[model samples]
Target: MEHIEPVISVKGLSFRYRMSETVILNDISFDIFPGELVGIVGASGSGKSTLCLCLKGLIPHAIHGEMNGDIWVLGQNTREVPTEKLAVDVGMVFQDPESQIIGLTVIEDLAFGPENLEHPPEEILNRMLPILDKVKLQGFLNRETYKMSGGQKQRLAIANALMMQPKVLILDEPTSELDPIGKEEVYSTILELKKNGVTVVLVDHAIEEMAEIADRILVIEEGKLKYDDTPKNHFQSPEKFLEKGWLRIPQIAEALHALKGKDLLSEKYVTPFEEEAISTLSAWLGRESNVQFTVD
Candidate 1:
């Protein structure tokens, strides 16, 4: 079997609306490899959505903007490629699932992409049934999309994207609309996608959750790419990105920060699980038995 290069690559990418002199994205560059789950994060209006649009070929193609630099998906330059063609190489799931969903029913929506691509009916069905199961929507395939919960609707949007079988999958705040249970379901789904060797790019404000799933994390600030590193390193220096208010700080970091001034809180507990956080703090406090806890 032949090896494939990165599914998505962006270099010196910058964008701004025609009427505005201010740039919404500036000198952003990143690469997403096959089977890697990468997270993009920043504060509100930090150009997260604009960057996503650019990556999806919607910035210059569908939206009017002054765009600069090169974005390559599946080895094709996005500047010269139409979204319809890029759709085969890259799939984008927006924050609002309702905005992306158009089919009256779930199965119809899932089939829309494959149908447009002129995929044979048998082949489409071959791929469809397994994907529905992958997303845990097996029984809901024929259900009306409007009747589905926010999380289920989001899954439908993802199914629509997956129907394309693109090399790269981009999700913008896939869990922002979900309740706690919904968030869990979506995250589990994402993990399944990663296991299937799909390149994943996630744009979200939920830092801790992303950390749990992402192999690499990139922080954008005022339209500029700032920090690019593994989740472990990003959490080690959350303050650097946290200062800009665009990066998501890990939950344990937040808990530790909240318990500042106590020696027990200074120990590292990077995982997302609450049990790990408690256990680490307990051990740290136990080690300092000689030092009594004094309420200030």
Candidate 2:
């Protein structure tokens, strides 16, 4: 089988809000391959949001900041590429949906990104329906944008980004403001995007949710790239995260850790899902039911 190349690459990346200010991203580097769902977790002010901005070519183009690094999304250097040109390949949905949305109706909002790219109206109409359905917004095309609930607006924001059919989607804290149902809708859309081979970068404090879906996890702290590993590997050694309190282990992982403290669990057992943990516990209980041990 042939190896797939990375779609996004960063090398020696460092960014500061101002020339004299403290660095937000300090010499961090990583790569994301196509069709990967990557999660970024960190405390507030740890540069998770700033890194998202850099991924989409907005740092030097739309926002003013001191940047020293190379960021290539879909093979174009972010520093040299125009934001408009990059937008064709990268779409970003922010934490606040209202800030990025401007159309009066859902259809209008979905049409904005495509229309600005000079796509004809008929072509846009042809593409809009399926895109709305992708986000589970099929019946909401004519609804007023402002009147939709928080989750709906967030999904619409994602739909607006998807309208352009970008190769990579960047979502910054996309589910932070949503309730459980709203978060479920948002996360389902994310999984669907991944299924369709669109690269996804999600930044959020929802570690449990990320552990459920992310192909890989990146933990940043104090303007540095701290841990970049699989979710299972990262959580197996929770001390790294617990030491600084920059990241949180999923509650399910905590329960499993507690189980491992006893002699029932294998010394090498590791998993992040509650269902898997339950299965393991059930099997252990069934086998141990016939055996009794005396305390030493």
For each candidate in turn, the TM-score is 0.85, 0.91
Clashing residue pairs in candidate 2 (N, C-alpha, C atoms within 3 angstroms): none
Residue 262, model 1: Cα distance from true site in angstroms: 3.7
The best candidate by lDDT is 2
Model 1's alpha-carbon lDDT is 0.80
- lDDT (CA) per prediction: 0.80, 0.84
Models, CA RMSD each: 4.5, 3.2
Q: In candidate 1, how many Å is residue 50 off?
A: 1.2
Model 2, which residues run further than 4 Å from truth? 1-3, 262-264, 287-296
